[model samples]
Target: MSSRLINEYLREDKLPHIWCPGCSHGITMRAIVKAIDNLNIEKNNICIVSGIGCSSRAPGYMDFNTLHTTHGRALAFATGIKMANPKLKVIVITGDGDCAAIGGNHLIHAARRNIDITTIVFNNNIYGMTGGQYSPTTPQGERGTTAPFGNIDKNFNLCNLVKAAGATYTGRSTAYHVNMITKLVEEGIKNKGFSFIETLSICPTYYGRKNKKGNVVDMMNYLKNNSINVKAAEKLSDEQLKDKIIVGELYKTQEPEYTEEYKKIIESFQKER
Candidate 1:
């Protein structure tokens, strides 16, 4: 279905979006909405939360129960939101800086707890909203305003990071892989425990300009050419997989979710009392 027709599900007055042309934030937002529609979740039952940075503008454009919180604090706020109600389907939208930099602690603990929430990291590889600063996921040897000499720091492999932190569902996809992205988001929403989706989004105005990546199409093509499936990755030597993009669902498992465990403890305490 056309995105315009899907507009019936959105709050259109909020439109004339704030993102630059070819930016993938809108695509990510649409993918989430499409996932929600596919899941048949009640519109009122889902809460979309966001942190500061360009990607944080997502919740503002979305029509669901939304919260635009302080910088790098969306996970903390989302945790509280999930705990208090335990019924709300909370989804946190954050940028790479917001998730892996200042919010690093919150991100890890939330995953460690297997919290019943979905975290979407819009990793455009730079601090797009704040003058194109280098971020934790920025490619090594890449140029940024802060890394004019080329970034010397290693980037975080978000999929492995979240997997190690114990997220029940972990996956990676790029804005270029729209079908896979939409599928993963849908699966994440339906999953009971913590779900982490790292979308390699495009920031044409900032990241593109700094890296000579040109336009959104160029970035998308880069992702397309570089991507490999997890199954295919197993056969390639470590050297061959270096700097290659791995797309598709990386890991998933069934585990007791945080809310369920929390509730069981509360019930047991009440019985003892």
Candidate 2:
């Protein structure tokens, strides 16, 4: 039974989504719409851009102005949309692999430019759409189809990476933390410059089954118990922080948005003409 808000925000004809049972992508997607509903942003003014992945499929089921782009290219497309039509609210939906691996350059450059776009990454730790391959955010030593024994590559801390690259806002939340996800997304939308959010979604079929992380209920409990708010983690030591999720709005600051800067440049050129 879909809520009125879901029916209103989501494309009803696409009901009975293809995501596996216990997949947390649905939870994060709802949070996106709920944030929009809570903020009361004009639906028609919103534009959703997504790259190829399980998370990317969201745009197809959304009623907003949607753009489904090539693998790891959502941010590039979204950047163009925001620059061409500064009035539209451009939001990106991406998975860990889609944003942090092949699309890593675009992600960093966008953050560096301080573009006024909201990027939400569903970091499931594995490339669920590509047969459970290890993603850039996969925990070191975690098993994936590509890493039969365990993942040897170091995982990326997306929040820290975006913050260092100059995003105006950065946040992290898990599917188990619904309210926090919604709030973070709302804050990201309200932010004037590049805003980034990473949600730890459960990929029960691939990640969970392969890693023996138990059923969806077990994974949810893991998120709830192993999570600490950014402020709370301040008092904890490195050892204590291990295996714990540092949740909440991790970073924020004021910055000139890219679109507005470009607009000023255009105005100056017109004055000269």
Candidate 3:
């Protein structure tokens, strides 16, 4: 099944992705492909956009209408594509820094507008491509190249941020939870308004070595042991949930999608004319 999906949806010429050995971006990428396949969406109708970062490299390898935009601007470019052709299924593949740091405004505004775009954030906690810099999602007290001692900033809860910013759908999953990532992404795609899915990936080369997170298997094990599904978390106490990663859909609701509302205004003007 994996080989068949790769043959059908991936650019074989780009074989052997550049992510470090044990990095989980590839797993998250595969989940995206599987979600698209499950929906049976035509390749031609999908537009995958990305900004500068490790995760952004995914669009280049994906067999679809892909846009490799400037750093922190994937959401801006995606917004244009969505506005120009509302019928297209626009998906943005971005990293934690690319999306939440430099592209933070775009993220919030896009959500505020409730645009019909699925944004999948491959958050590896650190700035993997640019260097081992601490990212917006990097846990406080974690070590990074920029923070040799420890990071003092409070990390952002991305799912909560997006949901509060007006995203109609929001969810969180990790590379260890591959099936859940696919399921959240699939559901996000099916939603009519802005959708955000944060996939916690592993940056073994940088994040692991800096913070002593162990190897790929160890990181995966940590994710498995520390994460609690939102539904299951309901029964757990605050102490049981401390430092625990919340997985599964965090929020979902219907809203006026930007493109659809824009189309309605155009139609109204045409009728008046």
Candidate 4:
């Protein structure tokens, strides 16, 4: 039997999500749900924001307060939500292009502000929804619609970017590593400042087919075999680390969250008045 909370919180009308087979979106969605369940936060206190893309479609399915905003604007909207309420748990779900490319500025500024919001970047390395256009996180030499010969650009290391931008919590995980991803989401929500999770999802239908990578199972197997925990990766050399996925918490530290600081300033002014 399903719990009343799960049943009541899930938008059953949106059952059977449109992500293709071997697509990691569904898995990532479950991970989010598991995290919320573990945290025991009331549905009313949670708000999900997403930008335009396959990943952005997530808000429509989740039961929480959701806003499916314009492309690369999820974070912008989420910032407003956090600033306006301060008490709500805001989460932004975005794809590689949605976050690293078009929404790059919003992402970095949000981290810089150390807002009390969790940003989950679903990095499949390609623009899955609007044809397989190469994204900022797409690995060099990877083939895509825009890069038939090969991509000449370097990929964005999202964890490093967010950490440098002052996020209080940063982590990376893949869909194949579902348990850890769920745990990371749980941790991000509980964190007091900006929390960023870069999830390496598989868009086998678009990214795989264009890049000569096999189906979903093959990608999952690759992730399982290639990934090493960050701690373990420290001991490996560049040659040994080639083609390997590093999934784990990269950095974490406590910092005064943006909203809390703003609230304090308001209270102080009122006291003075």
Candidate number with greatest lDDT:
3
User: Across residues 176-240, which tens digit of lDDT does each residue of candidate 1 receive?
Assistant: 88888889999999899999999999888988999898777888899889999888998999999
Tens digit per residue, CA lDDT, model 3, 2-110: 4999999999888888889999999999999999999999999999999999999999899999999999999999999999998999999999999999999999999
Q: Each prediction's Cα lDDT score?
A: 0.91, 0.95, 0.95, 0.91
Clashing pairs in 1: none
TM-score, per-candidate, Cα-based: 0.97, 0.99, 0.98, 0.96
Cα misplacement distance, residue 91 of candidate 2 (Å)? 0.4
Q: Give the CA lDDT, 0 to 100, for residue 52 in model 1.
A: 99
lDDT of 4 at 104: 93
lDDT of 2 by residue, 1-273 (tens): 678988899998997789999999989999999999999999999999999999999999888999999999999999999999999999999999999999999999999999999999999999998799999998999999999999999999999999999999999999999999999999999999999999999999999999999999999999999999999999989999998999999999999999999999999999998
Q: Which ten residues in a row have the lowest lDDT in candidate 4?
A: 1-10
Off by over 4 Å in 2: none
| Stronger candidate by lDDT (3 vs 4) | 3
- Residue 207, candidate 3: alpha-carbon lDDT: 96
Candidate 1, superposed: residue stretches over 4 Å from native: 1-5
Give every collision pair in model 4.
none
Residue 58 lDDT (model 3):
96
Candidate 1 structure, TM-score to reference: 0.97
